[model samples]
Target: MEETSKLQAEAKPMIYPSNGKAKEALINEKQPEVRPVRGSALRQVLVAFVANIGTINTGMVFGFSAVAIPQMQMPNSTLPIDEDQASWIASLSSISTPIGCLLSGWMMDALGRRVALLLVEVPLLVGWLLIATAHNLPLLYAGRLFVGFGSGLVGAPARVYTAEATQPHLRGMLSALASLGVSFGVLLMYALGAALPSWRHGAGVSAAVPLVALVLAAVAAPETPSWLIAHGRPKEARCSLARLRGDVCDIDGELDQLTRGTSISAGDGKSRSDMAASKRQTEKPEPLIKTLFKKSSLWPLGILVAYFVIYQFSGVNAVTFYAVEVIRAAGIGGGDSDYLTAVAMGVVRLAATAAACILMRRMGRRPLTLISSIGCGVTMLGLAGSLAYLEPGDFSILSWLPIVCIFGFTITSTLGYLVVPWVMIGEVYPARVRGTLGGLTTCAAHLSVFAVVKTFPYLQHLLTRPGAFCFYGCVSLLGSIFFATLLPETKGRTLQEIEDYFTGVTPTLGPPKENKKKIKSKELNGSVPV
Candidate 1:
């Protein structure tokens, strides 16, 4: 093990700057730039573009029910399903998400982020094709499962890759960009669903976008340099870093940091032995799972779970999936009403997400989350009140109220739940278990989604639509309080700084200074150890 570690370290490129000094010398020579280079910015944009395609695809699945519901309710239609059975089509996607999450998490750790991402396209393409071609319930269910699997597989790796690649200072903004992509995708799907003549056509069109995204990702996306360094391939790491950083930017200092973090020293053990030990340890990895149960990790996890429950139960999914039905139940007329409401909700969600990106850095994570939660709770209460008092036949009052409430819900969701939870999950965990933990949390959240989507129709049937929404409002209230108390403020902090904050350690915010006398003494002693 020791010999292998030494050899791996020795194989690393030992590049000295033209100024004839170590790279750290250059870092200490000036303050680090606040802004990233053009290449890094471009990479951020690309990551956002790819990552949000999954969200858009998920939205497409949700919107499918809107189209399917009408078909199921039609007088002469031969579809063998009621509203409850039809809801299963959407719920099936959520159920499949957790399975994909578990698989992708392990695969990402074993393979690499790029490989995990590329694999997702397989399920995604197949799912879309199935949905596009299906004439029966069984094929439709199979297609939705595939789409869910592909989206889940892509989620964690995309976030981890984007977070690892960008400078820490720009992390929030870049993360927000990914969220914006989700909003953009949702909006696009909503618009397409509204404009298209048939559900299958809409599904096909949505499927085509991800196919394009898959090709672009395969062709242009660079493998994360951090992953290469972790696997003891420093030369390859350097090349990947160069490709990501571009020609003019110097990556030697960043490379050193990556090496220092991942290096297995002679005193540590052999690389192969460490790998074996790691494999064995992970084979029965209790500590990794237990970390989420620790006091330090628990609050963050609770906050995430609470946020997701609120986000799902706050009736956003209900509206997104059944907007037209709800609007019709309120006595609004027109076959296009559902699609129109969906498009409007998507627009509001996009706007709200944009507002969140602008405000998140300034207000900090906790404050914005608190505000959004409280706002959503209030809006939900209003929705519940309007639903309860207004009779079904009162078209004048009932028609616009549901639409307004749905819009309110979308805006609040954008501000608080939709994007912030994802950003927090990416930020809060320790580097060693970040990917695994994030995937686990996402699985838990989606399980909640599975419950809500599957049971919502039944719940509405059992206790009118007003009762279902009222229950959601109460959940939103509890979630608001939980988030206000538990989540920490994470606005301008670096990744290392955020890690230190969670673990109760002080981070070194800047490079240490060299004392002139100490340096002279070291020079006289003929060497200095860093």
Candidate 2:
């Protein structure tokens, strides 16, 4: 209670808009030129873009198997694969992604966000190059593992950085931008798969993306102010916040808010014993078991685990890794191969994600997720029904029905379950455990992906297409109910507010509320600002 009150008191200077007038009055006396700055939001976008550019490569890492595995199955192909080998090839990256997620969690806090962002490109570049030149199963396996590891490394830092750097109003859009980058990357790979003669050439071309992301991170991205302050570098934190917010924002006041929000104290005039106690408190690490059991850590982790399980088992990844196979099974192209249809589905997913970025700015996370979950369930069931009943030579009549269901599944999944989980990853956890818990959440998610992707073929064989999709539909519907019950609405809430809700410091997870007592007290004193 004492800690929460201290945090609230520290946060009061910046959480409400009343401070704006005082800051404006102070700025007016200094310089008129610095009073207004345009495009602060644009600066936030630039940082977000840099942080997430690597996700495009992560997308390609996922989409690669969808395109590459089909090509490897060709009879005349130089590197051919049987069914077992193909499943391994398709699911290998997912197997190694958890390792990357675990490592980046430590590195995001131990090293820095910028360093993690920059270093992830190394494994990605090496992996793609290995795949491009691979001639055997071992080499292909090695490449996929490396790519998956790099993909894991990206989730923590990109979302964490974007969440900490941007303001509350712009945070959703920027954080969702990571998902948008992924959608674009998947679309790019699908188009490349359709156009390129060989998967090897596509791998070669994909190497350039991480290289570009590396350069962007090195040249443009700033270390998040929250990180800098937490690490005891207030000066750098001020500068970073300045760079992210531009001249119009009150960098000092925002920094103070950030300090309070992150639960770090300034320690201004404390005695030697007090300072020593504070140092001991902050430096002493909690046991992993205890940390995991804490309400702050446990609650958000539960939410994420439930959300990610739904995300993977709902067959989004099954469809992603096996787009061509799904399309073929749907009887599209009259029993012929069709990469273009996969590319078109990619286009639809990309467009839907783009819309999600806009809608995330306006809608609550819970509603969007519920809508997406329900939509995905309906689409999957629809596809199952269409696949079960459609007869041969019915291409002219209801052939497009299965395709429409598939497209509908893609659209609905992308809007909420696919994107919201990632956004919430950066939002829900408290700063003390954000890195560790974020990594674990991401690690668990990829493990689920691995299970889904690896077992997809077996599931299909055992149950047939309609039965498998029917299972997925049922799971998705149940998942919607789970999310609807527990998922708190996080739209327009600050990170501190969200953290407080999870910790039970506050009863609600809505937007920050003004201190009405303070305003009333000031009004009684006749000193309240107009």
Candidate 3:
């Protein structure tokens, strides 16, 4: 333990490319240590507001493609397209996410969050421009692919930025804000699709929102302090800490904590000279894949993947994609049925996710997830019953019942499942492996989405609507069981604390065993508490 303390004391921080540049700039300025400003609450709110713009932009682009596919079909119009070709417009975007995630992980580590975000925004702007002026099928597909790539790039960084910027206690609530942004974006898309007569206009409007968000993100957002520290710009990292916390009373202490918390000591059998040389020459190792294989990480990864798979398997994409067909099958006669259901689901999701923002902090993650999983399962079963038993053209019972089930599923989903799983992925891993592991888990989640969205129509045709819902119901129940058995509670714990829990490492809650001597001296000298 004494040896470990000495090594930690001598440890040098890792520096990324941007950190060196920032330090060079700071040398010429001679800036004072940045003090935390007043009105931290207001600043936090503003940061969340700006960060959510990225989330909203992502959802808007995703939702627009769903709304556009049927309109682009244009029945009997002889555009020389088949179902698979139309489906590619949406699938291409989903497939691009893993690639974008891999790239974003590298960029976030190298360039800092703000610059990485700017890179994502550039693609979105160009993609939206292409989408707005898409004259043919190829251009439309290209536009969708670019937009999807941009959205995927934003996902990991947006979460990382939001989580790193907030206080420990506030992390869950603030992190859930990204989900709220997605909900609102989806709602906006549904509303626009209903309100507009032309699909082109809806696509154009979707393209415009992200272009506007790109401008806002570029001008206003600050780089994450954690990213700053990782790059070796300790002074700028301190300034960023001050800006986010808005308090100076314990700024140095807080910085010390953050620095110590993130630092990784070189392993046994390495002399200090060798370690120092290694640090100077080598990049920070990416341990993400190896970490995922650990017994500690494997269970969480499984639970999270199951959560994502089940969430998608709830027939969300199938329903969203075929809302018009489902409504008609349910005996709803109006042409507006699809739009109405889409708008309703979006509204309910927004409200439920907003409620989750409040409840997740208060109620904790597990209970909310359990309730959502069970609720969605039961609701799906009910929908299957309605589909199987309801007589044809029984509009009163058929129309309202399925609509209620859809709303129930959407509401339950937002309350815990979708956003919380992503937040847990960010929280569970060590900083060394967080990005890569998170990306891998996210890839699994999204690949399930791609599979479901692409195949659900075929499944429905093969098994009928009732049979598909029954399958969804069974999968949801299994997910609930998985959550009950495997998912750990993460509320109110620091990242280190959560890491310790997963790794089966018992944390010293009080002073270190060897710190007793220092503790006595500090008390004798009237120094502040450790």
Those runs of model 1 whose alpha carbons end farther than 4 Å from true positions after fitting are: 1-40, 76-80, 261-299, 330-333, 392-400, 507-530
Error of 1 at 421 (Å): 0.7
TM-score comparison, 2 vs 3, better candidate: 2
81-115 per-residue lDDT for model 1 (tens digits): 77656788768888898888778777766787777
Question: Which candidate wins on lDDT?
Answer: 2
The reply for model 2, stretches above 4 Å from the true place, is 1-39, 262-292, 334-337, 511-530
Lowest-sum lDDT 10-residue window in model 2: 262-271
- Worst window of 10 by summed lDDT in candidate 3: 262-271
Count of backbone collisions in candidate 2: 0
Indicate the residue-level lDDT of 264 in model 2. Answer: 17
Q: How many clashes does the backbone of model 1 have?
A: 3
Candidate 1 C-alpha error for residue 42, in Å:
3.2
TM-scores, in order shown?
0.79, 0.86, 0.80
**Candidate 3 per-residue C-alpha lDDT over 1-530 given as tens digits, one digit per residue, 9 for 90 to 100:** 99998777665332222477766765745655443212265666677667667777666765775667656676743233567786677677777767777787777767777777677777776777787787788887788778777877877777777777776557888878878887888888878888998666776777666676677778777887766766678899888777776754345765665565521111234533234335534655435567557865765667777778877887666665555555666655456667777777788888998899888789878899888788878888888888898877675645578767867877787788766886776677655556656666767766776787678767878989888888887777788877887777887566655665566553322233354566455435532322
Instruction: Give the alpha-carbon lDDT of every model.
Output: 0.68, 0.84, 0.70
**How many clashes does each candidate structure show, in the order listed?**
3, 0, 2
Query: Candidate 1 versus the native: TM-score?
Result: 0.79
